[model samples]
Target: MLLQKFKIKSMSLLTFNLLLAIWLAAVLNVPFYERMQSLTPHTGIKSSLFIAASVGVLVAAYTFLFQILNWKWTAKPIAIALVFIGGFASYAVSSLGVLITPDQIQNLMQTDISEAKDTWSWHLVVWTLGMTVLPIIAILMVKFKPEPILRQIVKKGIASVVSIAIVCSLLFVFYVDFAAIFRGNRDLKGMISPQNMIASFISYYKKKAPKENLPLVTYGTDAHRVINTSKPTQPKLMVLVVGETARAESFSLNGYTKNTNPELSKQNVISFAQVSSCGTATAVSVPCMFSGMPRKDYDERLASHREGLLDIAQRAGYKVTWIDNNSGCKGTCDRVHKFEIPAPLKQKWCDAEGECKDEVLVDSLKSYLASIPAEDKTPQLIVLHQMGSHGPAYYKRSTEQFQPFKPMCSTNAIQGCSRDELLNSYDNSIVYTDHVLNQVIQTIKDVPNYQTGFWYLSDHGESTGESGMYLHGAPYAIAPIQQTHVPMIMWFSPAWQQHNATEVSCLQQQKQALRSQDNLFPTLLSMLEIKTQVIDDKNDMLKQCATNPDGKA
Candidate 1:
């Protein structure tokens, strides 16, 4: 009866749906649309017709797949919600130049008010209005058809099939041109506004649903530091600095043309030239790096449940704490003492209500380490997670002193800038990271009581206009080199090596070998002189460089 009383025109309903698809593809997907449009200049009637024909195919396919929204009871509300969410999330990725992966969704859900405030802008508000709000209001006001369900299905299906056929025919006619365009711009598909987010979320949900809330698996429960003759008299303090988005391609220490590592290069640091990250995003990389499993065998579902480096360290009689200046340690530090960037840090170092410079991770950090109530004989493991080179506001990361490159792309809307400008902004952030690491080393030197060593490696790397891709989070199987090749540098004080019986020269030579985040677990264990049941000899880079408590080489 309700359907009969409020009947709508079939043409009106179908037209609205088609128009919605067109708007989403052509307007909401700005990054993708721009790339497609730029492929062939709007030269004459032929180019104009090509653009129209290509768009028609896309909208037709969308209409065909979206006919599910014609279902009687549930489809309308769900479709509406999807459109709304698509608009909002699309705005986020568009403004931030980050990928819309499941990890990103999780991060968005977990973001605190303080972390969100810095992301707001008038530009974002206008973009949202244009993308979804007006469209939503228009969609709601438009009359929906009361056509018979069977007829609706038949009609929409035929329309969809015909649209797809037309697209196929067109592709066959212009196969060569279309193939080259897709080949050159493979990443354009990831920029498809809300459709990309929706697809990613659905795929993520399906994979995650089965293993939701599995029991945590503990490792090294029987862990205890052995009584080694080589154990230093002074308690050890080892800092593991997990950097965000610091690619080796931008670092001078790794042979980049730019002097992005001036401070780090000056220090007695050994830079591992060839280091790969476990994953391209923090959510995957952080847990994977800490897991005992190597990247090839890593299971994302198992990562959350399994014990990581922190748990093993804590079990091995080390007082460990995870201090985060970026995303919360991605559940890698859930079992440990986790500290956010101190809320009281001044604006010079951090913005309590917004994005904080990576410097805050080390500012007065030595004093805090001194305060850790470690048992007299226990060593300390401090994990400093930095917000290094996180984009698209790369210019904000570095202070005035470190801006070696001029004319940076300062805005969060990074795609609008030239590639050189983007690289300049990204390289500036690298310099700032160098400065922060130098300061951290200085603090370690100031602490006279403990024999300290620092190991710094990025969580993952960034993609700066490489192959027309803007940020990280390409699937790991085929992620670009820029997104996987990260910078790993280490500093071992002379006192630290001598006191801990570490052979610094031997460790430096081992730096030439290929390594990954998988090495962190057993390598650090070797540095701490803690051997556990789970330690893999092949992954332990430090075993040959340092002796056990009995001092056997």
Candidate 2:
């Protein structure tokens, strides 16, 4: 009887392993596999294999623990829970194409999960079915066997913990070496164990410094200052509109079918048709665009070392202001004047059933802009960061009035949404954005005495159901055009033209120049006429024009 029981347990273990192998194979079908291959080619094959093996081992260990503890009836439920957890975790990691940092993961869970509560009911249903109902059915089939004694279970639990630790150690080692190979960094010599190697790899990243650290030039400096020594001038006002989740592919300015940018198209706006983004996500792009570092070298360690464009504008004697509608992450605009919409007031914007709209943030913006102190300005730089077209809940992005297309709202979740539906909802958001942008441009146009120029660029673009992908955050190397091909437009008022002819001509030249966010730092300094000793002549767009004389082809 003992021999027969041992054979039964062995067969059960084999079945568990087989099921886990099938699940592991299916996990690779998630859309991010191709992107992962492109981003870290050196570790791509090994990492994929490691991930598969880890999942298999984790499932097997869970099965073994349940059996060894004689908690056979409970095994099915625990196994089901593990499956859902593993699948969701894999999906999230695959979508990002990298292992998410602890802070980022925490922030994402807090904000995105809360925001997605209403629309993600289907996900909850799936979890319930897998974790509860399926397990009960499996338990009934096994005749609901009684659990083993607590002492025996404790012994099995300790063994399972040890096994998990070993598996995790192996995974950590592989991941660290993979990252080192992908980044082309030399491997550590002294690190013998996986845990130590991971520690060393993290230390290396934390200690890495920015490739360049050029100081900013402001308006009062002697080398390149723009302050009027000859005569007094009126306080200038410039509004830099930092758009959100806006893709260039959908904008009319970038040859899209829809007239999404009708107002800006009608104005004297210069749209750079081929503008690319530094990163696909706001966390990286927002800081990178503002900082001096190019996307290739952008790292969190350099965030504090470098001053942003806002800092440059502020040092140039401009009052910097930031009005934000997005979730406050990393406090990117801490030094600037910040006005966040009240949470209680925002709650009212939700429907009787509790659904909210993006326009609610816009409504708050209108009131906030009107309340700004009219008197104070030594030339003010107001940054309006819109909640724009942030999604998954694309249907809630805008109202029906803005919806030009029918059957627009995404019927499925972001992952399953049809391309046509995604575009329709996305375009509607752009339409609403255009209206808000028009209001901002008109307000800037009406501002007296100040030479106003409005520049608009999205943090990054979005994937609207492209190649079975529905959102942004693809790895940089293989990030689709939808994520990087972003819309950029500059509108210069007649007053700006009258006061700064040299700057206007420089901007016009830059319009044709092969520009990136790297040029943004020096370009803003040149436009504002801020002089500083720290500006690199080689990187400065204006200096490039001065040297080339012939424009960039």
Model 1 spans with C-alpha error above 4 angstroms: 1-11, 25-57, 71-123, 144-193, 209-213, 230-232, 339-348, 352-354, 372-375, 499-502, 543-553
Cα displacement (Å) at residue 151, model 1: 6.5
Give the clashing pairs for model 1.
Answer: 228-549, 229-549
Per-residue lDDT for 17-102 in model 2, tens only? 33533443344233333433444545656767755554444444544444453345455555555454455444444432233332
Per-candidate RMSD vs. true structure? Answer: 5.4, 8.7
Tell me the whole-model lDDT of each prediction, alpha carbons only: 0.75, 0.60
lDDT of 1 by residue, 1-553 (tens): 5545544544444566677677665666665555566886456776767667676667766776666564545545655775787787667556545556665655456555655654566677787688767666555555665778677777777777787797788787767767787787665565676777777677677764236577989987777776657643677889999998889888899889989988888899989888899988887788889988899998878878889889999988898888878868877888887764455664567554566787778874754766766556568899999888876578888998999898898886676788788988999999999999999998898666678899999989988877666677776755789999999998987777775544566567665567788888888887887878888876777665444432222
By TM-score, how accurate is candidate 1? 0.82
**In each prediction, how many residue pairs overlap at the backbone (N, C-alpha, C within less than 3 A)?**
2, 2
lDDT of 2: 0.60
Question: Runs in model 2 with CA error above 4 Å?
Answer: 1-82, 90-114, 118-124, 131-225, 304-306, 340-375, 410-412, 415-417, 537-539, 549-553
Q: Give the C-alpha miss distance for residue 143 in model 1, angstroms.
A: 3.6
- TM-score of every model versus the real structure: 0.82, 0.70
